[model samples]
Target: PRLLKAIEQRMEQAQLRYEISGQPARVFSEFLYSTLKTWSRPRRVIAKAEHIGKANPRFVVTSLPQFDVDWKDDVTVLDAKHLYEKVYCARGEMENRIKEQQLDLFADRTSTHWLKSNQLRLWLASMGYVLLNEVRRIGLKGTKLAGAYCGTIREKLLKIGARISISASRSRYRPRIRGRSCSVWSGSGSEFLKHRPISLTPLI
Candidate 1:
């Protein structure tokens, strides 16, 4: 929903046409459920096992690659894992920066509880963003935007452009880009203006 919202906002601001297909919400929910399975206690696991007869041991790793699927020539695919890895690894110092920023966000809090939960979680999300940004930046580097996501036998990538637009009413800004003039809109800024791309390309 967040990324979808971003794309919609980007389209409105940049005067671009766009569309999204597939059931991302269902896929995302399933992925989250898979991750949560790893956190189940032994008794809870046994109960589920009894109900299902058998089950695989769960892993806590992010499953972004599992979401990859084929799309039409005009469509561009965005790899969620790639984006996550890019951002977290962008600076190689994300851990340190997280701590630094968390300190500031929680400076006035008297309890360590807030630090242990909310503040720490926000910083962790930032770390994830850093990694995602790095992946999107590096993987799509030097390639045309269409090539970044689409499979082409011709080896010709579609032209892509990124431009910033100001929203006077919202006092916000967004980055807009289209894969070819006729192609759809895409970017990290579609929903979250603060979520800026570390890099972009035409995907040749």
Candidate 2:
């Protein structure tokens, strides 16, 4: 019902734009709307009425206050266009992240015989995704793997063959590179971090 109202509004705006500009133009706006039967109170509803060859009306309901409080943080207060473009789009990007974890990182690999083993596998896969996300956020700032997916990073960076020699005092590794120098893999914001095992603490 709300969507239908937004489409109607968009149709009127499109007609007005066609009358004024002599061509179909895009119209965007936000409205404070509420359905009496569904919503308890009125909320900020964003509406985007766009027409290129056809009508494309989109709507999003947000609990964010428009002018209720002081605009201290820029993240809290946003215009109708920015809200739809950034905030709503970011929500869709989060779904992409979830898909990356499940598909790329093998989070859905749960064919084990035991339930506990499958649960552990899922937990380990999720933790691997978290750690890889942290690596991209904290470590891979300006490297080639900065925007690489978990599977891509694994295949390109982590799956390289290396020769390791262990002595009484120390261990040495000669990393293999396919027709490339070792310096390209070792330094220049491409050095792998040493992982130190730590005791797990319960989240409060």
> Which regions of candidate 1 are displaced past 4 Å?
1-113, 143-204
Per-model TM-score on C-alpha atoms:
0.18, 0.54
lDDT of 2 by residue, 77-156 (tens): 57787778878889899999989999988888999899999999889999999888877765565667678788876776
lDDT of 2: 0.74
* Residue-level lDDT tens digits of model 1 in 65-116: 4334556545333343333335334554656555543453332244456546
Shift in Å, residue 154, candidate 2: 1.0
Candidate number with greatest TM-score: 2
